[model samples]
Target: MGMIRFALAMAVLLSHLPLTNVKFIGGGLAVQAFFVVSGFYMALVLNGKYTDRGLFYTNRLLRIYPAYFVMMAIAAVFLFGFKASGTATLGMFEQAYTNPVTAIILGFEHILLVGQDILFWMKIEPDGDLVFDLANAPPAEDKPWAWQALLVPQSWSLSIELMFYAVAPFLARLNWRWLVALAAASIALRLSGYWLSIDLGLWQARFFPTALFLFIFGMLAHKALPLAMRLPAWTGWAATAAALTLIIFLPLAGLPDGAVRWITYVAIAAAAPFAFHVTRNLTADRWIGELSYPLYLTHLPFIGVVLTYEPPMPVLCAIAGSIALAILLFVLVDRPVDRWRQARAAGKAGPASTMAAATP
Candidate 1:
């Protein structure tokens, strides 16, 4: 599971590189794949560890926000100190700041991370009006896409993750049949975009409602955990290998883009439990898995910096620098916070501590 998570994060990094002709599992698919993983983990924790929703919510906040703020600060330094005024984030910030109301709203979204996903569905007019625009297309000359205002633009996915966290406890309580029905409905909504004249690229990819099915698929994978545990141990390794192969080599298999995506999704949903079952007890594997979150959060800033400075082999430099920063963040930030999170979950700290560790 850790290896797969790491690979998925790398896939996102590679996909974002300036190389125009390269093809692999892209940032979009990798993010959706992560939703599946998040669903499985959330289901696991809600069922096994959390008896109290408040603890669950607080612990999740602890897990996300600390590292997030660190990256946000880094982005700010680049935006102001380095005079990255030409960047979309800086431009968006400057334009939005001209209107006091827009500045306040966007500022809160940046700080709180609750409504960042809505930025994808909106645009900022030249006059600073934040208008709803479902098309999510590039705006007229001088108008900027609303998402450009995001300092950490990719944090939109974090907003989606937060939404899932908000609903996951109740979703975990549903019977398998009910869960299946809800997932089916979500999938129907996702696939209905073509006929409904919605832009599938933005809506299906970014919209919480349509993306719910991917997470549900992961929850369904969790429901299959018992079956996974009962299977021969070799099955776990085999499942992990198969999933890796699909993610890495599927593009070379000559399939249609859409078909490749569904195949990868289904493959990940089916394989995740087995992968976790195999890797759950390995200390090194868990540590590697821990890097994925910080890596995902920190990579874009490094990429932006390297691309701005035009270092030799900027892509490779960005990837290496991001990984190094992820290691530092994992060690300096995540490790200590995780100890506290674990203690709180284990009821070691106080009455607020009511749950147990769900994963290492």
Candidate 2:
């Protein structure tokens, strides 16, 4: 699973690399895979790890925020700072709004916004031919969708993850029958939008109940994990190879982007459980897996900064810098948090054991 995740993250990183919009395994598919895999892992943790909702949520936050805060800080310095210095004017940042201090504050503020709800109501008046309308604007309309509000545009997926985290405990508690029903409903809702021509847009796909099905897919995968683990090792490798091939070819096979994506997610979700067995004890794969989050979170801004500077080997430098920063974050931030979580869990277990011992 770790190896698979690293591959998906690399797929995203390659897609975002500066030189080309080369679709080497669609980034969108990779993101859906992340959600699917997340669903499965969260199910396992909720079932077997912390029973306290507070601890679960806290662990989730710790897992994400440390590196996230660092990435945001970097974004503020490189992206916002450069924009504020009046050196580069992209479509995303406005010249009048170029106060570096304000940009910095707003950059942090955006992370707190979480999702599009508060920003959806905002309407930026067009002054001097710049139109900023949050509700109806294109995803690339930066004046309304500034780094100040989004921090990192791609982090929108994190907002969806937040939504999933909020309800995962309750969802995990449901009986298998109920969970299956919920999954069916989620898929139905998404398909309804497609059939009815409702123009549901990315919001419907990104953070909707329909997306919940992917997580449910994960939950189902978890239920099957024991059986999956019993499969021959060759099966794992074969499924993984087939899934990757499908991911690459599906988009180019002349289907609509939406259809291609739907197929890709289904294929990966089916294969992910089997692939998990393949990497169960692989150390290097796990290390690269741990780096995947930092890579996903920081790569865009790192690449953007490099492109902004037009330094020699900017693409190469962005890849190197992003990987270097990801490894640093894994060591300094992510691993420490993992140890803290383990310690906290052990402490909680100790108290429970002592109480049980005393009662007997």
Candidate 3:
């Protein structure tokens, strides 16, 4: 699972390179992969884990926040301190708007990864002339979509994932019949906006519900399957083929961007987690796992540095620098956090294990 995640991260990283737009764009498939795998794992773990929701949420909170804050701080310094002048002239600069209060709101939204309601204004440039809209202009008399607010573009998915979490507990308590109902609701959400718009929390698009359905499918699969049984060989192959085909051919067909996204998520949910589980058995001795977290944590800053400066620094140096940053982050941050999570989990697991052993 972690390797799949690493691969996805690599895909995203590769996609961000200035020159590799087309080839790298395929990396977006990785998130769908993650969602599928997560859906399976969550189904497997949610019931057991929810016995201690506070602890489950806490561990997740801890895992996500540290690296995120570090990255945000780096972005802040790069955007504010280094590019202060450029930002003042070209971007939003004043402390009055995106200040401490903003950060606090964004910080919570960061955990969920959606800041959709973070209000702001937009003004289309005219005649190539720069125009700044007054801060927080009231919506035009009848216009509901005057401006779009985005602190981080990636966050839209995160918000939907958080919505899933809120609903997960109810789903967890549901009998199979209710899961069928929920699945229907998800589909309805997806199709409701086909002619208009899907009201997927805040996205106002079909992607969220489409992806959510894949996730729900994963949950259903886990609940339906025997622990010893792999997904039927033919079912698995068909899904993998379908997903890959859509991903490769849909754009060429002029299908909406969201169509490929849905296919990718379905493939991911249905296959990736199981594949990762198999891979772990085959490559349990690999070295990448130890460095993966740190690598994930620090790679963005490394890319940002290169991109912010001499961006096209020959592919070799860029790769080297990224690897070096990953290695360093592991040595410094990842190892420590890993040890912390392990020790904490071990501490909690200890008494139970000992009691079981003693009882037996």
Candidate 4:
């Protein structure tokens, strides 16, 4: 599962790289897979270990903030520095930040927007196009209600996940029937929204309800894990292969962007949890998983910096620097914090902790 996560993060990174002929896989699909994985783990831990709300919130804060703040702080420095030197105009800066610390201080909204799947209002880019409009250009006057881009654009996905963590305890408690119904409802709503031609402003593709099914699949996977394990390991490999095939080949087949395309994404997401279940307890896999978050969080920012230099080996520099930074953060920040979290949880639970953990 960890290895799978690392691969998904890499797929996203590859998709972003300013290289030719490299985007064979969809990074967005990988992110969808991430939500599913998160759904499984959050449900597993919240249900088993942090049933208490205060403790659960504390753990989530510790898990997300320490590292997130570090990244945001670095972003602020760059943004402020560029502004102070008059290298960039104050207008965009003002739109992105109220003050240097405001984004970090009031990050709760970003977390909540994740639940709604709304990041800020969609704005027109300087390039005279809407963000994420890979092919088409929009009318110049069209803009978002409000937009925030002081930090790396990729941070939006994490905000969505944080939103999920906020309500995961309750979500995890729902019966299988309800979970499935909710998942179906999420998809149906998005499809209906599309069918009706409702124009959701900027990053409309990111609407929370549209993607909630992936996470629900993850929760359902946890419920089905015991049965999944009972199956032959080859089944896991087959599911994984099918998912990778869909992610890589479907777009190349040049299917029109409609129901078929969307269904392909849904099916790929559906296959991921089963693939995740069978790949248990390998040290190599765990190490990759541990590195995945760091890799995902840091890559785009590093690339942003690297792009400024216009280096001949831009991709090489970005990948290397991102990997080095990820390794350093994992060692100094992520690993230590995780150990402390485990230690504290253990001390609080005493002998009963193992029994609780054993169930997951």
Over 61-151, each residue of candidate 3 has an lDDT whose tens digit, in order, gives 5555565555556545655565521112223323223455544543465555643333222222222222234343443322222122122
Worst 10 residues of 4 by lDDT: 82-91
> Which window of 10 residues has the lowest lDDT sum in candidate 2?
351-360
lDDT of each: 0.82, 0.67, 0.48, 0.63
Report the Cα RMSD per candidate.
2.8, 5.9, 7.5, 5.3
What's the true lDDT of residue 231 in model 4?
83
- Cα error, residue 234 of model 2, in Å, equals 2.1
lDDT of 1 at 132: 86
TM-score of each: 0.93, 0.81, 0.66, 0.78
Candidate order (lDDT): 1, 2, 4, 3
Model 3 clashing residue pairs (backbone): 36-269, 193-197
Error of model 3, residue 58, in angstroms:
1.2
Best by TM-score: 1
Lowest summed lDDT window (length 10), candidate 3 = 351-360
Evaluate model 1: give its lDDT: 0.82
Between candidates 1 and 4, which one is better according to lDDT? Answer: 1
Across 271-339, the per-residue lDDT of candidate 4 in tens digits comes to: 544666565545566777788888887777677666665667878887888888888878888888887
Instruction: Report the lDDT tens digits of candidate 1 across residue range 1-360.
Output: 888898888888777776444535888899999999999898888876667789889999999999898888887887778744223656667777788888888889989998898888888888787988776676765688787777778889999999999999999999989989999999898888988655679878888999998899999999888898899989999998998887778888898989988998899999999999888877788888899999888787787777777888776787898899999999999889998888777762333222224363
